[model samples]
Target chain A: MKNKRIYQVAEFMARVLTNGSKNLVTRETGKVMREALEGRIQSEPQGTVVVLDFSNVGIIDFSCAEEVIAKMMARLIQREYGDKYILLTSLTPNQEENIHAALQTKRLLALSLKGAKKPKYLGVLNPYLMDTLQLILERKSITARELADLTQVEINTASTKLLNLHKARLVLRERMSLAEGGGRQYVYKSLLEI
Target chain B: MKAPLSLHEGSFEYLLSQWGQRLSYPSDIVKINLRDTKFIDPFGMVGLIQFGRYLRLNGRNPFLLLPNSLDVLRYLDRMDFFKYVQNLFYLEPQDFTIEEKYLRRHHSDVLLEITSIENTDDVHIIVEKVRERAENILNIHLHYGPMEIDSFVVALSEICQNIPEHSKDMGFVGIQKYFYGKKLKKNVVKIAVMDLGIGIKESLSPKYASYASHWSDLTAIHLALFKGCSRYDDPGRGQGLTNVRKWVQKWNGKMVIRSGTAYTGLIPTWEFAPYKRSSLTFFPGTLVSLILPEKSL
Candidate 1:
């Protein structure tokens, strides 16, 4: 938006794309991204969409991917800006696997930013789903049935995703005693500690 | 048969209390039974190492019977105890027999003797005695590096020091070295230092009980070889036995320790097992043996 060459996007939405980067993703870059997302979200009050463009990036080592992006950037952005995040990359399967494994633990919203077919779905679903998941996480507890009803998805698909989230330890299940029943029912709760 | 080392009832800690005292001489023949004992702990390992060192030093290799515990064998393997004394033998608990000829004919070349604690003050005296006697008897040069010699001296000093500190009995140190004769072509050197006193079990268990299980002799052997692996609280960063084990293993040598009836050996393959009781019973002591190949300089 400002004459910065790093990010360019279409009208009605801001798409930040970084390219041809070689150096390790530093704390400075993470802070800048966080501040930008936070300012945009605060001004719009509808939350901002942030995409990390990694098309020209190579050798995403532990420092860049795991330490910087997954641990610091997503967390700072989510906490300060409530921004929806996506990863735009053509990473190799192994690199994607590593990034996915890292992000799976954080419960960050990540959509691959390649192939025009995905952009439409990304533009619409990314903002909606990120807001929903963020709400569920902040509330600290949500049922699969409740998520299915809200997302308009089938119960089975929502339950499957919730189970995956539980395995990742983003959420925990505890057996709760029901007043009307003799047996206990498992209740899901977020594991964010806060 | 000698009386078993006395300890507070059922406490394995009492077994190690005899680390540095004069043990009674062992008989040429030995017998071991593991049926009555439910478990063997580190103190028990000290007892066995002491006794095995005594018999091997005395020129009589004893036989042993042990429980079928792979965990025990694996534990001993890590310490490298079985690498030292070749004559000390082990069999499954079911295979033990007194009728079979217990002594191997080649074992007569292994000789063991004790030195008065007064002479231990001179490190050169003990080294010279071992080197001279080994060369004169076996005709093999007992050349040792400075680091190796220093480790040996440290181990002897620690054991001797423990004798006066733990065991009330006057500490006597035993020395044994194995030489190759014409019939036994392989050159091997075995040295044992023993004391009649409180063994390792009692001295360590009180302080370092959390790091070790009060159960298998093998665990005691394990604790003996690793750093911070002591049963003594505030154990003075002791590296005596660990250094001994490392030096011996580096040259493909062996070390066996006997505290009471429980014994652990470090050979090419580490084996720790309860050996047969010595024909002559030890009062209570610790025996540390080091064995190296003749080619090992």
Candidate 2:
């Protein structure tokens, strides 16, 4: 895991709005802020977890949320920001609802973290994929073999599910060597753990 | 011409109808007498401002005659009605002043003053201004909880953003809290937003050209409210109005939008208006009125 870079949305909004208003509620404002954040994310090293902290931010209406969060998630999945991952942090319930609604409209998924709380999933996820995501988040890191044993599923099923979650950018995959057979296997690690 | 005694969303048509009749004559100056006006809400104020601007654009000077009632004057002044109308219309009593003896208390029921929504920055300023008063007006007056207040502000933002996003012209918005003594018998907040620009029909024309044969102002509004339609083909484009409708319905409020020659929206039990109407006065832009009543115990 590379170093985590925290972007303060409130500070960025203050700079963007001449009046120093912290609310994010328009497509125009959302587009400008998203572009600035995208530029900053591009400057960060690969594999950096970009945390968008919206704690001090005021209201984020649906349009702005769609313009920023949904669009960013769409691009992130397309590998537009390289190998970096995006995590939302310190979002108010109201903000979460708007962001979730926007993401659901676009069929995207994002993870949000609050202080000392279990990471919450925002946006749409298939029920089956959701189940697999919960397992990965809970175990922090798990091998396909271990997942298949724990869930009584086929090895290929477990591997496919893990790969799907990784492809969705919800988990990080790394190669691990087995001590018994001296063979290599893939391990899926929770983004929160990283 | 005489302005309606009760000038509000319900009577806005009367004002428009009167203006329509006078449109045939070529008069350099149009006089709108308000001496008998007893009540005027935010809708009336914004409607009057837009009317004045509309007349000016049509090569006519709009003149407003002040109401005789001091209470009405005070209410108008408190809502900053004079500040906005100063440049739009020529006041009859050009030197009118409020008597110091009847200077009322600070305005607590006004959620937002008459503000222009010219661009996105104006929307940010409006959201900021309303946030400071949402607790007092939306909470204390309308009994909205934290989540409801947040939703209310967000809905307001989305509605105002529509002006600059699609209107292609400047607009105005005003909000006030009033106690409805009839039917609901509770405090309700009224939000009025309007713009004189391309109406919904014109905005949706590009995407819905296939339906051009059966299209009207009413069809455009219905498509937007029910189908979640927009002019843009982007999947994420048209959720603003739909979400606002959902939020209003969830809170048991009433909302009505009038664009071009038609009007449609979700009407609550207490209100009585046509759910959908077309072939009305040919207004050039869109006008929206939302009423969120106090929550029942």
Candidate 3:
């Protein structure tokens, strides 16, 4: 069960795209998202969950999808929007492909809507990454050696999976220096654990 | 100017002759005779509008010698061309009661007749109509994936959007289904747009002035195919051209861009494609046409 409240982006888009052209321009998408985010920031408290509603939008091009979802998620990540969570709801199959492709290109992640209270992970993930992510979700914080032992994968394989998760912006990694100066180790925390 | 300006889809000489005459002027008074021009298309419509605007800009008041053919006159009236030339030019339709004239009724075998794209609103209409034609047309049928048709629609919208966005002038888009290649002889969807505003050379001058000045039309077209080649610094800009190119390349389709005095054609063998001279002597604006295979590849 999630505690953060959700907001809809379609409310803002309803004000725009009155003609309903299947191919939406990038500027319109960007402008609508900015306005929606502005409203979300003001009315919602910290840790509030925002759901980008694509139910009304039937078609969106790559550039338009990039400007709206990928760029916005990147900006939020770059600025460290720690408490707030972004999810998507009512995505058509085509929209899912477009939004997923854009997010994958930029290596960003956001939760997807499964039901009223259910949020599902949406993005590219191989079986290995899936197991790694599941383990991280079970254990809030874990090191490479611990992940390797838990997954029964090689240390290098585990490290590679962590690095890939880090690249996908799904995991947070920090270098941990040994107390006796023996060596340095890395600690990875699943950002989705929240 | 008494020459017939139909410059029909396949008429090369007429286009050259009309364009040459428009460039050469001896007298300040301009009078054009459109009597014999019974059939009109988007290419001819753009030529007429551009020529009229050109005369007005040069301090020359132009008058139209009304067409002898009632069909031609009605075609002009239906297209809202009179609204453009009403104030500046001398036209015979003084709200005057002449013979009750109506355009000749004819059906084009193509998916769509030459259509005017005056605004963004027109883009939606055209895209929807084209999609409808693909669905309902008897001879040819297209079974597109969820995104395939949408991709084609977006690519087409980008082509039409160029008219209102960059042309800063009116233009026309004509989409049709036709056969291509003598050996293969396969049916394909053909889309053509004619614009009479600043050509590729002028549009790219902001960012590639040095290269544009020296580059021929074909060279400019080749450069235009690249992504991120737009003069504008705005994000999410300039990707459409690349997208269109990739779409064409995927199907090994054929695309030709003609502007200024040169033109370039892209065929299936694009890796070794070279820019070539166009059939026309001189064209004022750009004419971009492409042939996409019926089957998605």
Candidate 4:
């Protein structure tokens, strides 16, 4: 099971900014806000899905997007915070463009949701991996055997794809015991579903 | 020194040519006389302030003879130019005042007054202040939509942040909307951000010095504006100016960055300026001018 938490970026920006501005610009202010966010993420329990809500926030420039979103994704994949996931919510199209550019620069990927719309990928990912991610998101959770049977692929190829997604920190992997047999298998779950 | 009668970003070069010759004599007091000046834009105002600051740093006592044109004086006062020029330049008439007729009236077209970009907080404030007025000036005057307004503020913030981020010096920024009836029959907004510190060449030299063919201010600026080069090796760096240039082009606007001895950037076809020019008069630091015209269609 994963615990979900919403981090209001507008609130974070207001707390960090001396002036009452919701717009995030410049690397200096970006560093300050990201450090504070990292501190908050550190205190959360393992398997926590931190949703960065950009609902009230204003414009986010490329510099700040790189400093905050790209750097955070980079560190997340490095396991700097240890077994945590991040998702974005309520991003404006302009914000999405800048954040996507920042993520593409570092070849990082993130999942975002807009209201009732389906989850969307915000950064660069191989088409194969993207299709697998889409499958996992649709199923909410799936074991390697389940994925192999659903996609009609070899279990090893399915397992490798799941492992790659897990390595990217895009999905949470859980150890599950097979019901019919005594062997253990890994189950990959989407962060959004949790 | 007698300043140009019609002072603006373009005419500022004439002032620089005169000042460049007088740089050898640091002890001389240069009186920048704007007595006959009729029109002045945000670039000219902020540029004068930065120029004054630069001269003082070089051990020169500079004096500014106030413009005799009441219209120009009123515009300067409306832009709060006196607030910054007080200590930077010795005023000829210390007690000069604006007449009641010249006082600021209701409904200001001034999108943003002359403001300083000293730190991160200042950039935020500048962004917020401009955002507040963007709906009025940017939307109504420039015909910019919500996204365009957002881009305008973001571009402004990114450019202004360059002072604290790379220039290693405090700078001034001013923005205003004007009616351009001569060349373009629509309104336009002019933005100027300038500083007197280590310029683009010096800033990028540490990392990109050896990788260029005849490294110069023009080369450094092209690397920055066109190629998105930054001093840091981080892949995510240096996209600020490149993105700004893209937005400027999309809107059919003009953007120019003038630094040490060279200047370059996007110049729309409507404006008959060189795409790139080098071997000009040497000026410390960077001077950026962006003119976004009202939507043609």
Question: Best-fitting candidate, measured by TM-score?
Answer: 2
Q: i-RMS values of the candidates, in order?
A: 24.7, 0.8, 3.6, 1.0
Task: Compute the lDDT of residue A61 as modeled in candidate 2.
Answer: 98
RMSD of 4: 1.9
* Candidate 4 residue-wise lDDT at B237: 92
| Index of the highest-lDDT prediction | 4
Question: True-contact fraction for model 2?
Answer: 0.91
TM-score of each: 0.33, 0.96, 0.67, 0.95
Compute the lDDT of residue B256 as modeled in candidate 3.
68
What does the lDDT read for residue B85 in candidate 1?
26
Question: Which is better, 2 or 4, measured by DockQ?
Answer: 2
Q: Can you tell me which runs of candidate 4 are displaced by over 4 Å?
A: A149-153, B25-27
Off by over 4 Å in 2: none
lDDT of 2 by residue, B1-297 (tens): 788999998888888888778878877899999999999999999999999899889889899999999899998988889988888899989999998865656756888878999999899999988888888887777778877888899999999999999999999999999999986899999999999999898999888858667988988988887788999888899998999999899888999999988899999988887787777878888999999999886
RMSD after CA superposition, every candidate: 22.8, 1.7, 6.6, 1.9
Per-residue accuracy of model 4 over B156-180 as CA lDDT, tens digit each: 9889999999988999999999998
Give me the runs in candidate 3 sitting further than 4 Å from their true place: A1-10, A17-23, A26-30, A41-49, A80-145, A150-194, B1-18, B28-134, B137-146, B163-170, B176-188, B210-216, B233-236, B268-275, B278-286
Q: What does candidate 1's lDDT look like per residue over B1-297, in tens digits?
A: 222332111233233233222234444555443333444433344345545655565666555555344444433332233433223544335333232243233433323233444321333244334433444434434454433443344344444444444544443444434344652345655454556555665556665556654543444545665452544342222333554466567766766665644556565643233322222233455555555655543
Q: Arrange candidates by DockQ, descending.
A: 2, 4, 3, 1
Error of 3 at B82 (Å): 7.4
DockQ per candidate? 0.01, 0.84, 0.26, 0.76
